[model samples]
Target: MASRSVLGDIRRDLEAYVGSKIRLRANKGRKKIVEREGVLEGTYPNIFTVRLSEADSVRRVSYSYADLLTETVELVVCTASGKETKFEAHSR
Candidate 1:
């Protein structure tokens, strides 16, 4: 219903950030917060992935657009000119 449409809009907005550097902040419940800087690697119909490197290991995290709408995840995309754009989904 309406939530699906909201998710769709959020997804579309994020699609443009694919292959770009982004900062992610996620809430892991119980007052835990995880933050990372990575490149937005891919986008699917329902989710998107970010690739992060730590030490010698690389991690890929996938999050749904709905997570943004719920404020579970937040993204900040950095442009070539050093401009940053924050993306978060909110009810209209």
Candidate 2:
């Protein structure tokens, strides 16, 4: 199980990337994976939101920091200079 401090760390790291473009890769169980590109909207105490542009619709989604700690969700932040940085949460 992930520890409390680790989740806190993940939350802090994500907070720094708010308003940046991000690529989200989520594991939906049973060999299913969903990917989307969006902008980090806000970071709250337990979760953060993202604004995404889908096939003709704009959607907002939120996920918990625990999701990153458990490896269920992966976030890749895209910088303006064409660099991609992957966000990771490690339990210690």
Candidate 3:
């Protein structure tokens, strides 16, 4: 199947309301194991800005995988020695 641009869509959606408030999920840490809900501060083509609810700190997150799939997404966390660690996603 052809991969759709999911990340691109997110960017466009965010652009529609540049200064408005919105809810977003962000992954913290290099492993992306920690997820948190926060307010959407800004959005770029493949990047999103958020102020973390916990620490009230602003952070940038890349959403380049949005176009991968409609219901599922995958992230490659590591690849070494012919082994790989990936994150599988199911979106509503």
lDDT agreement with native, every candidate: 0.88, 0.91, 0.45
Q: Return whichever of 1 and 2 wins on TM-score.
A: 2
Q: Rank the candidates by lDDT, best first.
A: 2, 1, 3
| Candidate 2, 1-92: lDDT as tens digits | 66778878888888899999999999999999999999999998889999999899999999999888888999999999999999988887
* Runs with alpha carbons beyond 4 Å of true place in candidate 2: none
Model 2 Cα RMSD, 1 decimal: 1.1
Off by over 4 Å in 3: 1-7, 17-32, 55-62, 65-92
Tens digit of per-residue lDDT, candidate 3, span 18-77: 444333433444755444444446766555555545675566444544532332223333
Better of 2 and 3 by TM-score: 2
Output the better candidate (1/3) by TM-score: 1
TM-score of 3: 0.39
Clashes of each: 0, 0, 6
* TM-score for each model: 0.91, 0.92, 0.39
Comparing 2 with 3 on lDDT, the higher-scoring candidate is: 2
